[model samples]
Target: MQRTLQPGQRCEVWIAGVTGESELVFTSDELLLEAPNWTLDGSALILNGDGKLWNFDVAGRTLSQVPLAGIPDLNNDHVLAPDGKQIFLSANDGHIYRAPLGGGAAERVTAVDGSFHFLHGVSPDGGELAYVGIDAGDFSQPGRLLTIPAGGGHSTLVDVGAGHCDGPEYSPDGKWLYLNTESFTSLPGHAQLARLRVDGTGFERLLDSETVDWFPHLSPDGDLASYIRFPHGTEGHPADLLVDVVLVSTGDWAAPLHTWPLFGGQGTLNVNSWSPDSARFAFVAYPLANTDSSKDHVRD
Candidate 1:
């Protein structure tokens, strides 16, 4: 399958099973949506498109826009709080904002200027936010993993010397923070999954391979971690790629337990989409027709 995506293309949502079959949950008219975050109650999937947010009910198969009174330039780096009541959104203005999940005016959470902040995950206790920060003036510079008070306050740098990093998610127990980092500034850089203490200690790589890995989301039970893998030498994560959703035992990261092949990348598994019970996950796959053959299996 060709791995290239264009604007205004078609897409679909899928609820992936652990050992059985995958089911189509919703389909979009255009490629406007990116990243599907399962609602706390698992009743609906929240997605973003063209700077706006919408919620699609799984049972009713309906869609509704999530009202944002003043914020317009929203990105895919938004995540719902652990409590499932508030949402933290990353805007184009280089600031993160918090707002009610249902819909309302978003309040700025980061006070930084001339920089971009992309939210990745919220702490399980709903008190802190983990994200990747990039210097707006230098696109070549690697992004830094940072955290801040969920209520809005000064941010603290966690990955001090890493050249590039992305997808900073918190573990359920709140003891460790997981992310992907590319240590070089050159093109076709190799990226690998890693984790560190919440206080920025005991940093180590969890999974390293030739294929560039991004966005490692730990299950609610912290027993398994799933991430998207871009083909080797892929410059950056782009949509419509023949990517693999690799699932690994959190207790043993040496090998993936199962790999699901699909015709989607980037938005496919950017956020934590595991169900409350950790039995399944929600992911967005582009162009409904190509997903019929996408299935899961243990790697050879």
Candidate 2:
């Protein structure tokens, strides 16, 4: 069944039942915000706006603020360990940091000084971390996906192809890692999803589309994937980020089962969490009203 809203301005949550279409579970003015990132356990939702991490309980509908000490001048492109023990987030200086889920302090995990780097995703087993690194001088060359121990150790180069790669998420069973890779020479701003073998052999392209695809979050069953699509048409002006859920079969993305359209042209739509049954998902929307390079949270 499909869901169609009446085009209201409030942020709401919806879930699909065993039969019939999805129904509204809850709507809140205090909970949802710009760039909300959800925890992997699906019990709490995390929203990062105004430079802080806020946690909201889905079951209780309560809110708690997490102190992101030692993590200053950075954004919340982060992932929680499957056991809900640690969080791996990126810094504006191009490094990855690991912090306890209880929210006290963070420790630096990767160091690529004079270069820009960011963590794409963390392995569900909490054993390995996948990230992208590039030279500060050149931003066009394909970035490197480095797999290192979650507790901080030597890094292993996973892929070095000539395409920009970012936003990696691992399967629930810890067998496959999915990411977005793009090239500028042959394909300007095209984005596609590629699957990496965790056993250290290599990766294969799962879905290739001209639209800029990013943030592929896999469901608990590992049969479905949700992502954000920034189509190529809205260049220069703010790009309209489209949230989509796709069904996968035999390692191939079959079709986009559902999609949520964006209202503001230059804002980003965040896919932070997914329900345990894979019937519902949560995200934060920010509409960029204008262009300002200094502020990272501003949508326009």
TM-score of each: 0.90, 0.75
Q: How many residue pairs clash in all the candidates, one count each?
A: 2, 5
What digit string (tens of lDDT, one per residue) describes model 1 on residues 208-288? 577889898888888887888889987657777788888888988768777777777877888888878888887777744
Residue 162 shift from truth in candidate 2, angstroms: 0.6
Assess the local accuracy of residue 66 in candidate 1 as a C-alpha lDDT between 0 and 100: 90
lDDT of 2 by residue, 1-300 (tens): 111122333344443322223443345434334334456566876655445566778788876677778876555567676677777776666677887777889888876565565665777667888777777736655677778888877878775367777666677888877777764325665767677777645767767676666667777777666666666642221333333323334345645555544432221333336666665556544323342212332121
| lDDT of the structure predicted as candidate 1 | 0.79
Error of 1 at 150 (Å): 1.1
Best of the candidates, TM-score: 1
> In model 2, what are the clashing residue pairs, if there are any?
238-266, 288-299, 288-300, 289-300, 290-300
**Against the correct fold, how does model 2 do in TM-score?**
0.75
